[model samples]
Target chain A: MTTPASSTADNHAWLRRQARWSPYELAFWLAVLIPFWVFPTYLTLASQIAITALFAVSVDLVLGYAGIVTLGHAMFFGLGAYAAGLLTKAGWGEPLSGLVLSGLLTALVGLLVSFMIVRVQHLALLMITLGLGLLTAELANSLGWLTGGTDGLQGVDVWPVFNHFEFDLWGYTAYAYALAALFVGVAAARRIVHSSFGLSLRGVRENLNRMPAIGSPWRRHLQIVYTISAGMAGIAGAVLTHTTETVSLDSLSFQRSADVVVMLILGGTGRLYGAILGAAIFMIARDQLSDMNPQYWYFWIGLLLMLVVLFMPKGILGGLSGLLRRLGG
Target chain B: MSEIMLATQSVRKSFGSLEVARDVSIELPRGARHALIGPNGAGKTTLINLITGQLAPDGGRILLEGVDITHAPVAARVRRGLTRTFQINTLFPDLTPLESVVMAICEREGKAAQFWRPLTSHGDAIDEAHEILARLRLADEATRTTRHLPYGKQRLLEIALALATKPKVLLLDEPAAGVPKDESAMLFSVIDALPEDMTILFIEHDMSIVFTFASRIIVLVAGGVLLEADPDTVRSDPRVREVYLGSAHGH
Candidate 1:
């Protein structure tokens, strides 16, 4: 029999093997600083892309990791947007605190809704989420006084972050802010999905019937992931709201939710860095393609999406990773 | 006499008009190796389900270590050391055998809720999972995705998952139903070698395997216990010869 020392070494080696950072993650972190050097005037666009990527990652947490299909994820995003906007308008305009508050509010909403959402699966879950998103939109439309209705909540000015970096018209500070949120959100989510709780979520996803038999509190795991995902989505929303200095009904629209889901699929679901790549490819493509063909940009976007879904079902990043692995690189 | 670790009192279950378990009563003493046997549709699996809290009995109470647990949830029952395995293999098909077992071990250790720490950091759970896979002779396939494993090995992996929980009363619906004849021996041998402190109640159709491994046999017919006796007595009963074992012995 081999010595225990040899076996422990083998286990350590396996752990180290899993610990290697993917090139995608390294490039993403390094790429966060690129807008500052190359395209200072395009900081607004870069910040929007970062915020959108973080939203997609949040959706990926529940949809990809926890296996909860949702069509109303933007409800949390919108709530966070409105919360930040309202907080600033209400004279408590600390940007970081506003972000935290908005995220917490969205998470609280998620916790409450998870009672109904987690109990159902698949079609029912999708419909309930859609209904909730539409309901929130309708509420915002009707509550014209607080939400500012069709015109959006106007006259909201975000205070400079940390009383230091001023909000510039070029969006340099905003880009940094969104990237920081993404970095923290990604770190926390990566830690979570690699943990035992995350494994149990995969266990629930793979065999929900046997999860309870294995002594897992399946419902609780789902609720925790759902709530955390909601909070992350909220942070993305708050960042966008603070960056743009407005919270609009568009934040609550079905289009926003659907777009994030598309971003997740385009990036791949379970891989953490896929969301960033997906959002980047999507946002950048829409930006560039729309500028070239303002009237028929959807044509090009739709064609690209169809090709992606047809050929790369695991999403663009997952396909690239697989290809790289097969090449023995 | 050993203490009664599990008991069901006149438990009854009905699916619409069809009664699956009719006033079934049972007592499982600690460390006992008992096998439940009957023909098809005998409510053997239903009885296991009721004991494991998968279904609530229509009529009586289920007691675990003398405390009523008829109303407990499946997870609560499992945490109380009463665990079960499905007749059909149920496992995380995408996870490696080692990961699946480690998750089960973590669930048992109440560390499955630890989200911030990487699961690999729980070196104890990983080591324990490795040891269990080795015991089940599945160490070679430990890192292989369960879906890629042979069906017989999947069946053994099912048992390995149950053993990871360290259940006080392990209720196996059918541990060898789909395993090959040769592999079935290896599976039962592992079951036969389990520590005597962990009581086992398994449902099996294979009389040869049951008679060899089970110290006591409970025969069910039409959702009721027809007889409960030592394996020799059960094999020798005239009624068993008539209703179940007749003409099939070929021996």
Candidate 2:
């Protein structure tokens, strides 16, 4: 029914649009399509990437956009994991409701913590956040009865997503679920950073002293963003708990906090897509290198991170963009 | 009857016996085009900071519209319509002038909390931002990030930001400090054209600029008021002449 000439022209236009894709957009599509083209065995790896990216992006919301450096973001993640686990144990194993309930509960804790968090800046803020994360980890460890005492939360059960897709052993459903949540999280963060409130946050980041004269309560703004960011992190934690059907003390560990921060910086901070790119690269590298040499994989990661900091302070996406610019676009 | 737009009563401040303000009191009525003149380090900026609630006074009351705001926070004071600029230009280095003005306008209108909508969707804020940039003759540079602007333009943008808030009491600390004399004229002309009811208190080192913009001038020496009088009287007062104008003429 279509003319040959018109069809050829349409094909040409489509090719042009494809050629014009930003590296981040290209990467996003590739990530979304991993299950179709990648080995079926790597599907769980894809799920891990998606969940870790969600966590990294939430950290970016605070560190990258709001300029609040934190090493305690894992506290929110752990709170969410525990909340989802407890909900499932109580016979309410609905995935969507679990995600929301955990997110809100983590947000409430984040809001309370932010009062103290926003009062400090720079090194003090960093130290306080780190301390808070460690304290939560210790609490989970000591209160084993509630959190399974370092053995991890036992017997967490997740219902099939919407009663349609069973969580297969090959992780097709889990990967899909995590990717969808990541997509929604990225979309929401994009909306926030492009809003008027987001502009004011950057203003506060650039110059805190000038904010008062412009009639902005910068502390209040920082607090609100921190709470929202923590909630986003909570969603990531809930996703991991539901997919694996287990919650562990590692969820609250400082190492988890540090690793995500590293991943965020590796992919670049401030921009949302950096979270996805960084998480994929970090998790995949860890998986492969650890399989190759289980004892020294961290050495390689540390080396890679050093190289990134030294040569590309802006991270992977930022470096790529700069390269593209210098090469005359 | 004209009422006091801003007043400070016997405010005292000291940094470990290095007194910056010693029992300084001022009553600036509405529409008063006043200037605070002093030699360097006489605490002209400190007084502005005190009135704007940046630094708490050790002793005294600051009242805005006869309501005491001595204990108010900086944001609260700005919301009550008191705002100031700095001797050194302070602006969001990453934001464009249009974005900067839009943010100020939004914050003033209590729209800074709306996080769901795109900033460009606020048609009223965007329109008002454009109008303000045009008034300040910064329309051409509206989209340029403020860090890349010339010093004179940055200074103008600082005033533009303060103006966007529709402040009842606008305090500009050395608004023309880094600007060339020729451009400073242009800057003052813009300030000159603002509504007459907006009480303005500016600190300036240029005697010509001060005499032209301010109806009354208050001179300070060594952290204390030397004289507060109409321009002509302050210009001729021997005490002011010995303390400030002497140094001015000597230069």
TM-scores for every candidate against the unseen true structure:
0.95, 0.93
lDDT of each residue in B204-243, candidate 1, tens digit only: 8778899999999999988999999999999899998787
Reported per model, the fraction of native interface contacts reproduced equals: 0.66, 0.61
Consecutive 10-residue window with the lowest summed lDDT within model 1 chain A = A1-10
Return the lDDT, model 1, position B118. Answer: 89
Clashing pairs in 2: A144-A149
* Per-model DockQ: 0.53, 0.32
> How well does candidate 2 score on lDDT at residue B72?
90
- Model 2 interface root-mean-square deviation: 12.3
- The regions of model 2 sitting more than 4 angstroms off are A1-27, A326-329, B249-251
The interface root-mean-square deviation of each model, in the order shown, is 3.9, 12.3
All models, RMSD in angstroms: 2.8, 6.3
lDDT of 2 by residue, B1-251 (tens): 68989989999999898999989989899998999999888999999988998888899899999999999999999999998988898998977787788889989989887889777666677778777877888877776668888999999899999988989999999899878999998999999988899999999999999999899998988778888999999888888878787776642
Docking verdict class for candidate 2: acceptable
